[model samples]
Target chain A: SQQGEEDPQALSIQEGENATMNCSYKTSINNLQWYRQNSGRGLVHLILIRSNEREKHSGRLRVTLDTSKKSSSLLITASRAADTASYFCATAPSGGYNKLIFGAGTRLAVHP
Target chain B: DAGVTQSPTHLIKTRGQQVTLRCSPKSGHDTVSWYQQALGQGPQFIFQYYEEEERQRGNFPDRFSGHQFPNYSSELNVNALLLGDSALYLCASSGGTSGRAYNEQFFGPGTRLTVL
Candidate 1:
């Protein structure tokens, strides 16, 4: 399976704190993506990092990918209460049709 | 520029029954994919359709089938439903051309299925 396995299935932190989640996958990938889901609803895409890239960032999110280790991490700096949601890591295979295999996800709780 | 859309939002069914869920791809997107997400788990790919044909499928059983129309609208049909089938069904859309690499997927709100 090409599924990404997320670490720290759950995490709790105070507002303004940095929250980080890690994911490891079994096979090579073309890219790794992070998504946020609130209330088990539709997932909002956060970012995508290609295998050739080691790190990337969006407004408040920073992602690092280590293809040699087949692992990735997502860092949300100064998270707010509104940031509370389940975070998932999905991988697109290196040599296959674009079907993503997702991890169980990390449940994040940001307390005010 | 509408994103992916799915319906009905929710459904209830019993064992041995069949149900069909529908989806409309994002504007300009011609490929559609379906996923099943069990409680507390991430979404699992069921299948994908492009150009009104099944392009790829996951490990899902034949009981789960789908169709994609020329307009890029899609449907997921499940037969002989079981209790384990209860979950959130998600639809995603990407790619405007059949030869393009659709790496970025836009997801719909999803349809929640409850099996009795």
Candidate 2:
């Protein structure tokens, strides 16, 4: 079964707009990570936020995790057309192997 | 350093036939994992290999078996393939550690397997 589920299956916005995506999970997790994938390409690891951490930032990518709610969100600020891709949230279950369970991803379209 | 690499960017096979997909992990990485992604859906975990052993497996059946070489590269073999088995096969590499917090996995360009 899938552990994480992302909301807003699709989103479209003009360039320079910020894109935010949400992910909710069922079970307790040690960490939540986000990835980006271009069409017909491999997934690129973006950011990882641990359970102890509330928020993290890498360049223009910002991620927040709320263990109390078992949810997390990814924010891409000042989005550009090159940022158009599918974003996924993955959860590493607590007290188990570090295998990552991925969510069904949100597709973002940045129109230039 | 090269990221993960997969062979045969695309392949075509018939139902009931067998297929073998290969992957080479990133340099200095010892763990390899495989995933299957269908159209319009997220990638599903197939199994993971560590130290040349099947460390953990997903809900996939026995038909989907894999082997990891001493060098850490791995192969995913699917026997008696079905049409539904056709999907993009992705390979990811990471260091083998249990509780080290953030261990980001690097992925390879997936192999598009088409079953006819």
Candidate 3:
């Protein structure tokens, strides 16, 4: 199983505060991706970090990948009430047909 | 320009019954994948289709099968459905096998399946 496990299954924070989520997976991977899912809706792609990349940033989101430790982290600076949603980390294992294995996800609640 | 699309939006079925869910991949995408997301859990890979054939599959039972048309549209069929089969069926699309090293998948709204 190439599934990733996210730490802190849930998180609650106030508006304007920062939120960080971690994920760990087994087996080597080609890349890791982050996604956000709203209540009763499908997931939206957030970012992708390749195995060789250490860190990348987009807008208010910063993603760090530590291939040596088989882990990754997502940092969202200045979160808003609309940022409240479930965050998932998915891994595309190496040598596979590009199928992604997702983690259980972290449910984030941002209080306005 | 269109993202992946799935239908019908919602479905209800009983045990031992059969159901089929449909999906249309994003424009210019030649690969389609299906996932089953149970409550409180992440989406589990069901299978992936490319060139109108099953290129890869997850550890699902034979009761769960699929077919991809030449148009890049796909269908997931589950026979003898069980209560545990209830979940959100998501359809994702990407380029083809020769795509970039990191082929980003675009997901659809998903079809909610409820088994009684």
Candidate 4:
């Protein structure tokens, strides 16, 4: 079964605006990673935050993990039309680190 | 250096037929994993391979099987396919001491499989 669940099935925003997506999981995780997919193609690895990490940043991407709440959030600052895509949250379960479980995902549209 | 690679960018097959998808891991990687993504949904883990063994599997049935070659490349074989099996198949590879998924994974372009 899918371990992670995301909110805001879809989001639309203008360029230069910040977009945030949230994800919640049911089980404990060793790590949580985010990925972006364009159309229906391959997924592009984004930032990953360990269970112990509260926040991390890579360029305009910022991710936060709250283990206490079993949730994580991804924030894209100053969005661009090129940033339009589907974003997913994946978790490496504490019980089985070899299997990555993913959430449904959020479709983001950045309009110029 | 080249990243992970997969063959036959797209494929089409009929229900009840079988299909094989291949993947070559990135340089220095020895573990391969597979996932199935339905339209408008996140990718679901199918299985993971290491040392030419089926190390771990997901909720998929026995019909979904895979093998890892000595070279670290892998193949995912689906027998008696169903229409629901039609989806994008993704291959991911990582280099870890125990072939664990906790490490960052490099993904291939994925093969689009359509079942009629």
lDDT on C-alpha atoms for all candidate structures = 0.92, 0.91, 0.93, 0.92
lDDT tens digits, residue span A1-47, model 2: 78889988999999999999999998988788899999958999999
Top-scoring candidate (DockQ): 4
Q: List the residue pairs that clash in candidate 1.
A: none
Q: Considering only N, C-alpha and C atoms within 3 Å, which residue pairs clash in candidate 2?
A: none
TM-score of chain A of 2: 0.97
lDDT of 2 by residue, B19-43 (tens): 9999999998888999999988888
Q: Between which residue pairs do clashes occur in model 3?
A: none
Taking the tens digit of each residue's C-alpha lDDT, what string does model 3 give over B1-116?
Answer: 77899999999999999999999999988999999999889999999988888988999999999999989999999999999999999999988556434588889999999999
lDDT of 2: 0.91
Candidate 3 local Cα displacement, residue B85, angstroms: 0.4
Q: Chain A only: list TM-scores of all candidates.
A: 0.97, 0.97, 0.97, 0.97
What are the runs in model 2 whose C-alpha is more than 4 Å off? B96-102
lDDT of 4 by residue, A1-112 (tens): 7889998899999999999999999988899999999999899999878888999999999999999999999999999999999999999888674568999999999999
DockQ of each: 0.68, 0.67, 0.70, 0.74
lDDT of 1: 0.92
- With candidate 3 superimposed using the best TM-score fit, by how many Å does residue A91's alpha carbon deviate from the native? 0.2
RMSD of 3: 1.2
CAPRI category for model 4 = medium
List the TM-score for candidate 1's chain B: 0.96
